[model samples]
Each structure stands twice: as C-alpha cells, then as structure tokens.
Target: MPSLLSSAIAHPARNQHLLLLQSSVAQTCLPVLRDVVQRSMERAREKTILFCLLYPPLSFLDKASRAQTDRLLVVDRTTYVPGYSDGLDFNDDVASFLRSAIMDSIQSSSLNIVIDSVDTLLSDINSVSATTRILSELLSIVRTRGGTSRLIIHVLAPCPLLPILTQTRFSPSLTHLIAHPTALLTHIASAYLTLPPPLSPPEKFWGVFIPISERHYESEKLVYGSAGEGSGLQDFVVEILVRGGADATGRRRGVERELEGWSPALGGPCEVRELDSLKSLCSEKPATEMQIVPDPTQNLPFNLNLTQEQAKSRAQVPLPYAHEGKPPVQASMPAAILYDPDSADDLDDDDPDEDLDI
Candidate 1:
C-alpha cells in the first residue's frame, strides 16, 4: 500500500489541490513538485503551468513554463510592480490577475498550477480572507474545467502575516478552524501536509528543565537547501479530505492525522517510508485500536498493571455490576426479581397498626 505521503499527494480529479504548510525552508516544495509534475506528464502527456512567486526552479519545467513562471507583475523592491499603472500594486488585484493568467494559459488537455511561495504571497497580500477567497475561486475554475487540472499550493507558515503560528501551542486543526489563515485552505484542499518545524535545543530536553523558550530564530543564521532544524523539510503530518465527501458548506467533515518519514535525495526529489513498527503488525493478532489519548491513570506513583495474583484476587471480590457474594448465576437457576403480596392486598390501616403486637 502507498504510504500516507503518497496517498496525500495531489492526484488528478481525485485529489485536485494540496495545501502544504511548509517550514521556514522555501525549497521544501521542490522535491514533491518534481514528482507531481512528472506524474502529471506521464498521466496526462501535457505541460503543467507553474505560477511561482519566486523564480521557478529549472529542474522540472520546460523553457516556456520557466519563462512564464514569475508572471505576476511585481515592482523590484516595493509593493507596486513597475510597468503597470504608476501607483497600482499586485496586491490591489491579485485574484483578478491570477484568474486572467489561469484562463489564458489553460489548454485542451490539462493545466496544473504550482504556487512555490505562498508565504511571500500571503505576506504581501496581508489579508487571510482575501488569500483564501482567491484560492477558492481558482479551485472552482479548475473543477469546472472537466479535466485533470490541479493546484498544488506550497507555502511556508512563518511570516508576519501568520503571526508565528509555529511558536504557539495550538494544533494545526485548531488554527485552521479558527479565524487563522489556514482555515479555508485546509477546508478546501483535498490534501493538507504540515512540514512542522523541528524542535529546538530547549524543546528537545524531554522535561529535564523548563524551557525558557521553545524555538529560536534568526534570519542570517538560516542555512538554505538542507533539512536540519532551520534549513529544509522534515516529516509530514498528512490530512486528506476524501474526494466528494465535503458537505454543503464546502468543508470536509472529518479529521485525522498520519505521519511518515521523508528523506530528500541530493539534487533530486524524495522517498517516503512507513515506520519500522507498522511492518510487524501483519503477523500479530488484530487488537483494539491504538489509543489516541493515553489513559489518564497511567505513569503515576503507584503501579497500574496488576500481577497474576493481584488480578485473580481482584476478580474473586464481589462487585455490584459483575459479581455477588453468592454463587454465580447459571442458565438453569438464573437470578430473579420477586415482589411478595402482603396478605392478599389487605387495606385496613388503623386496625392493622393496633393488632401488630398480637
């Protein structure tokens, strides 16, 4: 069976779009994009248009796709892209520009969009609702196209726009369900992957000492093109909304989390692996599901697991629900409930009290 990572990948119409919550590393999407684009080519025999905010990487795209990669009008260093109206900015009409680009670039067979730097886009756009709305419109457009069109939205999570979501104790689902920017994206995308930032020195201490802080960050110290704490990608927390399972509100109605390991190859894409523990489950007898929330009574000063003698003794003791002081109930002589009638239902209240002694 395919790993969770593979299953969560953006498929044709089956899984149209993906919202990737990336680490600080910008190039975390490169490996997956290579694989997805390759799959698109093999399956559809067509080119995928990449609408990248940064310059597109050369490894996957053709000369044409590369030329059109950074198609969004941008001024070199400011909010306004020069060559457009003097004071107008990309942010002023980002959604319209994307709609025009997508409509123009679409062809007979298929079209795929890879937004490489949604972090920067969100930073510049500065409105979570607007960003989400634009993506939804694009999703609707692709769905109506009646072909293998898909959108793979790859974005880093840390920016001024997101308010340092990584530093918080909040779960991704909580953030997505709240007013946070992640909500609509997670709701709309068929698959959502979180490349969580690695634990810093303090966070990794395993309760040795109270951490003064959990994560530390510095811009200049970041090492690009590597998967270490501050550099590149890591394992993914994959959440897939089954296709066609959304409700009338345009939100998937369930929640689950699956994790798998990934090792990015040098100068290439990546490989995913199921954990070592799951492989041994085949031979083992099927058991009750692994508990998600652990038993609250565990890991206390007293031992919880019983020895054989303790268990046997405990079993012998009578209890209200399971056992009584007498012999066990049997099929032939089952326990019964009886109500005695008092003297054929006599009803002489004053005289009966006086005659009770006699």
Candidate 2:
C-alpha cells in the first residue's frame, strides 16, 4: 500500500493539507515534502510547478535550482513574495500576495503550492488573525480561480514550533489534529496528516490519518461530517478498535501494515488515483484539454442569471447615484461675476509699485 504522502500529492484541488511531523522541520519534514514533489514530477506526463514560500532563511534552494527532476519547477519564494528573513514576509495582506503568486504560476503549468512551516508565520503573539485570514483565503483560491487547473495547496508541519501549541503533552499533535486550536484553520482545512507521533505504537507503523467531510459552514466555521467510521480520527482508529472484518457494506477498509524503517528518499512512487476523493485524477487532464474558467454558477442554489422580464426589471431599478430623474443642477453659471467697478478701484494693468521698486 502507498503512504499518506503518496495520497496527498496525488490529490487534486480542495485539499488544504496540514502536515504535522514528529521529526524536525528542516530535516525530515522538508526532505519528505521535496520528495513528494519530485515523485509527482516524475509521475506526471508534463510540467508541474511548486510554489514553496518559507521563512527564517532556512533554505538550500535558489533561483538556479528552479528545475529539478524531469520538470519540477519550484517558484523560489524570494522571487515571488519580497522579504528574505521573514517566512512569506507578506504584510497585512497575505492573501493578496499569495493569490498574485498563485495566479502567476497558473500561467506556467499545472500548479502545486506549499505554505511551508506555517509555524514561522504564526510566531508573533498577535499574528493569529492575519494567519487565519491567510489560511482561509488560500483554501478558497481554487474556487475563486475558476479554472480546471487551480493549484493544489499544502501546509506542512505547523504546530511543534508554535509556543502555545507545544506547551502541553497532547496539544501539539491534537492542536494540529482536532478542532478549535484555531477557528479558521480547522474550518477551511480539508486534510490533516500527522507523521509518526512522538509517542508511537510498540510495533511501529507509520500512522496516517486524513479526514475529509462535506463542508458545512455555520457561524463561518467548518463542521465535519461522518466520513467512513464516524469522524476521520475515529475512522483511522477503527483498525485498532475493532479487529478486522468487512462491514455490512462489505467495502474493504485500508488495512494498516507495518512499515520497516521508512525514508522518503528511498520510497518508490505510488499511483495517484487510489483514494476516495472528490477531485478525480484517474487520468491526467493535460493543459490543452483544461478549460480556463468554469461556469460561475456551477453549484449555486440561487440563480444569478436574470430572465428577460427580470433583466428589464433590473434595468428599471434606478440606481441612487445614477441621477435618474433630477435635471442637471447647474449652479446658475457662477452668478455673472459682478465686480460692478468699486468707485475708487484703479484698472491700470501696469505695476503701480514699478516706480517705487528701483
């Protein structure tokens, strides 16, 4: 069976991933992420672009290193979002900057974007709101782009480095896993992958949990529905809870097998269309085949289109600023400038002070 990393990279849009790694951010997390991109590039028939924007100057890549294996193009962060030391280095409007970068990349090739080490961005005591808005907007990029090739978003290794999240025993992993650690994060985030919890099972299998629910927004927060066996967490644990047998539906659940000393660099590639996801990548939809913008009113319940009668009605709806009926209120042509010659006024054009100015 393929690893969670395989499933994640293969998945199309609507996957705003949160990867929580037990290993160090620079060491294990980064290599694993790079390998995912490399594998994707190798498997893909054409070009793929990776937008990896990070912070703290913890990078080994540069402008010259843009093209890796067959054709994996990495849009170096320094080139896109200005500022070097700060991760993403975006001002208050992180969304606008990120969207601008993503839009630019969409023109290049099939896009895969990464908000690497979000821990660095959320380090400040007051960046919570900005960070949330950034995440919320990033998840919505696919919908707003209105293209068949809207970029895939990946958020890797978020919690361990954040001070608030790392304080408690379970908070770091649970913070990344369960809800309300951050309201907008859980609401917009589609998938959560924790790479080997620090406290591991004795037998040692790489545990991967990804929960996807039909998104329901109430009070502007995401609420997840029952996926397979209750919540995604509960579903992932079903293997440990009830020793195996197919359910009444007889749908075979993914049987967890022990992995022997796994390293991403050594792992072979897995096929893409293995998971049960909304975005299907059964076969690659090449750029030539993809439509630029899909119909805006695709899945909306309310009608945005107007009937002929309705269009006429809308045309009749007088705009307040349109000045529909009021005649042009011309200001009486500046009331005929009457300087009716002040009795003592001199009309001389020549400078009166010329004689005194010598």
Candidate 3:
C-alpha cells in the first residue's frame, strides 16, 4: 500500500523545490497543512526543519505534534506592534528578518521550511513588488541548495489580488509586480495544491495537486482521472481528506442504538403497514368538487364600432390574397396642365388691379 506522502507527491525522495497550498477559508486548510508537515517530518527524519508561522501561534503548532521534535525551529512572528517591535515592524524592511531566517536555514543540512501564511507576509510588507522579490529570493536559495530541502507556502485562495489583476488592464511592469500573487507563486513552485472550502459539517475538504515538471502515467492519475486515456501530461489531481469526528475518544452510543434494529436477520423483512392504513383513510374521505369562476373581463364594455351582425358577417368573409387570380386595378393618372409665369402674373394683375393702387 502507498503511503500518504507517496500518494500526494510524484516522488517522495526528490530534490529541493517549492510547494504552494491555497484556500479561501484558513481554518479549512490548516489541518491539510498540518498533515503535509507531519508527512514531511516522517520522511526527513534527520533533516533540519524550520517553521515560520504568520497566522497561528506556537501553541497551534503543538496540534501537529511539532513539540515531539527538538530539531523543529519555530519563528513565532504572528504578533507585532506598529511601534513596539522595531525588528518586526511592518512598514520598514518588513520581511528582512524572515529573509535572514530563511537564508540561514538553507545553509544548514538538508532543510524543510514551512511558511504558514504568505498572505500575512504580503500584507505586512504592503508592497507587492517587495514582497514578491523577497519570496523569489527565498525560493532561489532553496532551489540553489538542490537537496532534500523544500519550501511549503500556505496562502488564502481566491486571493484579493486576483480580481484587481483580472479586472484592470495594467502595464507589463505593474502587472508583473501586483496581479494574482498566488498565480505568480504557482508558476514559480515545482508543485501547487489548492484546498476548497469545507462542507457544512467541516469534517472534509477537497484538494487539487499539480506537479509542474514531473510526468505521470495514466495509472498514476487520481481516481476520477484514471478512467479516461490521459495525454501523458502532468495533470492536476484531486483528493478528498475526511477528518474524523472532533472527539474521537467518545463512541456514538445513540448511532449504535439506531443501527441495532437495522439488521434484516434480527428485524425480519421490511413491511409497508402505514401505506395500507393511509390508503384506507384516503378512501373514506369524499372527493372534493372544484368550482370554475367566470372571468370578470368577459362582462367588461369593450366598445368596438361594429354591431353583432356586422362582426358575424366580417368573421364569415375570407380575407383576399394578393397572389389570387384577381389582379389589383391601378387608378388612372390625370393630365398635367402647363402654366407660364408671365400668364400667371397677368391673371394676378386682373384679379387684384382694383385692390392694389400703383
């Protein structure tokens, strides 16, 4: 049987690379991130590990059993005051500390670095270009190491920058710096994974994973993808992870009771006693009489200028067709009379000689 890590990754024992995971809701994806980190730790037993958490505190890391490993180095930069912490200040060289830490980690033995939320880093820097530059440098360092070192970046899905990038047509320079930050990371990363919002119960969520440069066979495709003949390309694969009930220790006694009588051998065959009773009750009731109401508009006075007899005669007569044998007769044109301007002036003089005095 394949392990969880083997199933998720194309090759578990690969070189240094980047993996990005994104989701709309943070809570829904935290578990998935934890799962990946746990799996990574299992694979890289002697490797140096670094966790840079931006959203949750050190206590949240305990949930993922990070406390068990002494090799795990955690940088709790989740809390920062605008004026108090000079090194953690967001406005001035915000990512300088983070960059330094990542650089130090890459220099050590085969390293595994996990940045909890890249969205928080971008928010603090407040400059897309600067934040992107910082991330690019960090990724470059990891790739340069080219060993078991890997970088996992978690970001929120449907990133706020996506809409601005898509709606507004910006210049090439601005577009490169500002638009769809997650999309930019996706292109940079060796593999990308996205977590959709959780269902109503919040126990399960869907994840899509795509390996950038790796070629996968049709048999290696996900359950749904395995059905059709694949193009032998690195296709995006989807997996659903179901988290057991919050209280795993407590057995559901009520559910067990409900299932007790569900066995056919013990309860006998199923019968529809209610169906016959319902039919008997319905037969006792008399059929209802439906009354048709006359239209109110029927008595309305619509005064068209035709009598009942004239309307009947008009309705009986068929309309004449232009295509019938009876051709339409054209009216004769009257002869045009020619009038000279000089003759008209003489006629006007005769008519108005008495009326107008020269």
Ranking by TM-score: 1, 3, 2
Task: Write down the worst ten-residue block by lDDT for model 1.
Answer: 174-183
Return the lDDT, model 2, position 342. 77
lDDT of 2 by residue, 196-216 (tens): 223234233232222221121
Worst ten in a row by lDDT for model 3: 254-263
lDDT of 1 at 188: 19
Name the lDDT of candidate 2: 0.37
lDDT on C-alpha atoms for all candidate structures: 0.42, 0.37, 0.40
Sort by lDDT, top down from the best:
1, 3, 2
| Superior candidate under TM-score, 2 versus 3 | 3
| Off by more than 4 A, model 2 | 1-3, 10-27, 40-110, 124-126, 143-261, 268-358
* Tens-digit per-residue lDDT, 206-237, candidate 1: 23211211122322122221432333343322
User: In candidate 2, which residue pairs get closer than 3 Å at backbone N, Cα or C atoms, i.e. clash?
Assistant: 55-87
For this target, which candidate reaches the highest TM-score against the unseen true structure? Answer: 1
**Residue-level error in angstroms, candidate 1, position 262:** 2.2
